[model samples]
Target: MTDLSKRRLKTWIRLLGVTRGAENHLRDYLRRAHGTTLPRFDVMAALWRRRDGVTMSELSRLLLVSNGNATAVVDRLEADGLVRREAEDGDRRRIRVRLTPEGLEAFEIMALGHEAEVDAILSRLSETDLEALRDILSRAGRPE
Candidate 1:
């Protein structure tokens, strides 16, 4: 392989390793500290962002998860009184899920800890390093 090709392959591996490591750490921290799974937190985060609520299909699409997967999480959240599912006005078959007031409060608490955890995890990187890495990733993600 050409030198450029070889270097690109190594870079991809390093990127994947870093991504997986960070994800695993976050998952573990959430489970241990919050008594919640990453998927549950993700669902809450999505609902928190859309105060007006979102359809089940929209939630699935936003999370890039299957309908069944999103439904299961929503079901649990509803059971815990963290979220509510209301039938759409014009469409009986459609249900919009949203965080309840209690859910919003709960998520706010979790969000604070979540931010602190992330900051601690990435604390090794200086501000300049973070900016540089963010710039590189932003450029890499953009379509040519």
Candidate 2:
């Protein structure tokens, strides 16, 4: 009921709207330009960062997704020859998933376009505005 409470509520709604809008735009761009879903791109991006590969558990943890979800994506990527799952040397029950050479090349191509798409989407924000927004968000996201 207080003025401060109303202002905070409005700010929260605006923030959510902006975040969803950006996400939707990126999703559309990826689907239209690359014929890929956001989740697939995210999995590839994570694998690209870790050339040595990661365990299925680790991949799920890294992406904050469920093991089954990560496994499904990995399964598809492996089928496409973009990734390989190898049994761990010491642990037969455990497996590590890594991007294949072809996967790396494919991800590189996608990464370039992804960067450009993001740039285009945020083109309206000036450098100064971006820096300011980043600072504000960083502070807000941190625990008090």
Task: Choose the strongest candidate by TM-score.
Answer: 1
**Candidate 1: C-alpha RMSD after superposition:** 1.4
**Model 1: CA > 4 A from native:** 142-144
Q: What are the C-alpha RMSDs, in order, of all predicted structures?
A: 1.4, 1.4
What's the count of clashing pairs in each model shown?
Answer: 0, 0
TM-score of each model, paired residue for residue: 0.93, 0.93
lDDT (Cα, 0-100) at 73 in candidate 1:
97
What do the candidate models score in CA lDDT, each in turn? 0.93, 0.92
Model 2, residue 73: displacement in angstroms? Answer: 0.9
How do the residues 1-144 of candidate 1 rate in per-residue lDDT, one tens digit apiece?
A: 999889988998999998899889989988888898889999999999999999999999999999999999999999999999998996879999999999999899888989998998899999999999989998885555
Candidate 2 lDDT over 1-144, as tens digits, reads 999879978998999998899889889988998888888899999999999999999999999999999999999999999999999997879999999999999889989998998898789999999999999988885555
